[model samples]
Target: MTAENNGTGTPPPEGDDDPFAYLYRQEGGAGGSAQQPGVPRRSYAQVRAVGERQYGAQAGPSPQAAPGQQPGSGPGLPPHQPNAHYAAPETMPGGRAAARRQAAAAGGGPGGPRKNRNGLLIGAIAVVAAVIVGIGAAIVFNDDSGKQSQGQSDNNDVPGQDEDKNPKNPKDGDKKPAKDKPKPTGLPSRTDAADATLAGGATKQTEVAKAQSAGGAYVGGMDKPGASVTWTLKDIPESGKYTVFVRYGVPGKDADSTLSVNGKQSDRPLNMSNFAGAKKGDWEAGWAETYSWIDLKEGTNRVQVACGDSNTCDFVLDQFWLKRGWVK
Candidate 1:
């Protein structure tokens, strides 16, 4: 008998309604499609069961492996689990393996990785060598700079050195003024020599009417030709060129004489005539002065004043003076 609407198996109301619509319809908000409009479809629970058994719990099936083929277990590759976290180095197939094989073919053998490591090491060594060379060059350059600076400093000090060695070089136009030289001074001591005697004709000791000196005495009457007055100085402490100053009196006329010390004639003769005209008076009343110089020997000395060629000495000799040095 045919199942009717009232029986356990019932026919749906049919007015252009699909007989298999319920089979393809959504179940518990999950959707599935059928091969044909009238064909039945599997349920969501059944589809989920099939997927779990075919693939892993969380991962989809890899396209590289066929339906029955294992993952990462291709021919000429190592055996590996399909659900493992990572594949072995030898089992890393497909594009990565193909790339590694290509690299190995280009590089010679399995030693390609080692060669790459060696190349990296060589590159690092080259970088280090370059850095060291750069540092060495910098040090050399700094040394040269220091030497140049020292040379410059030495050059700068050269002028001062030269100035120190020769403080007054004529070539230096702009020079500081030189200090003045010291003036010449007179002799340190004097020797009084008033005692003398007549050495030749017409020369004798005379006394003045009025005292003008300590002894008030002199050598007089020197009017004869070849007459001379002599003095023998003793105990002379020094031997050097000495000055001889003569104090004398003039009576309105001039006198001429020459001096000799130790038998050596003076360089120049003396003229006592110039002293008499400066003052007009008697011979013994006014005194005048004249001087000459000669070298005196040590211990004792002999000085003689002789009349000139005119054969007459009119002046009266009063005293003698012996100084250490002569005037320039």
Candidate 2:
């Protein structure tokens, strides 16, 4: 018989006479219609299998079942595979093991694929941070080195200033200090005959007190015609005419002597006509002779006296005087 829904939405109970009565009963209902006589009844397991094939797979009792699990196998459900389009939870945040540990810590059980993706993102952030830090460190190091080099350059500049201000010790590039120039001796100067440069027959010997010379010495023995005497004058104050006074004596007649200044001879030989005879030995009677003004150069000069060609024209030379003013 067909079952009718009571006013309370409940079906009537099945009759004791029909063994298939329970098959037509609604789940959790009081009763239902009996199965038809021509059709066979299906078991609970067969009915569930047909339902799974028609609709999508539903959640099983436990989530720990391995893949390809047969129905009715123990308590666990079949292994779950997430959609291929989504990134696996294991490859998201951390490695598979670490992700599993995190999931376990969060009470997510295990085998979470989203955690692995998070791990990849964290690793990327760490790498970017490291690169940034390295670049910053390199920039700082370069700046420090540049500052050191500039400081060294500044230090080098200090020495240059010192070299310019203090000239006692000079550096390689510093200019040398100027040397002091010699000053002129304004007063009259004299040279003794003994100090003269003698050549040929001229010689230095002791002379008597009457000799017109100091230092107890004079240049004598200049009897040969080729004998000569030279005196070096230095530190001349100015270039002008100077009078040369000679102290000399001739044992015989007056003599004629040649005078050369700076290798240039005088225009005329100096005539020695005012000779006084010697008392005893040669040049015992000394006489002072004055010459006309001669040109004197400023600085070192050579004054030379040579005997005339005749041997009798030679005389004893004691000393000479160079005065700035002319002789009256």
Worst ten-residue run, lDDT, model 1? 1-10
Best by lDDT: 2
In candidate 2, stretches whose alpha carbon ends up further than 4 angstroms from where it belongs are 1-106, 109-120, 123-131, 151-155, 158-189, 210-215, 234-239, 249-256, 268-289, 297-300, 309-314, 325-328
Enumerate clash totals for all models, in the order shown. 0, 16
Residue pairs with backbone atoms closer than 3 Å in model 1 (clashes): none
CA shift of 316, model 2, Å: 1.5
Best by TM-score: 2
The TM-score values for the models, in the order shown, are: 0.37, 0.47
lDDT (Cα, tens digit) per residue for candidate 2, span 301-321: 888888867435557787787
lDDT of 1 by residue, 296-317 (tens): 7567778888876743467666
lDDT of 1 at 131: 100
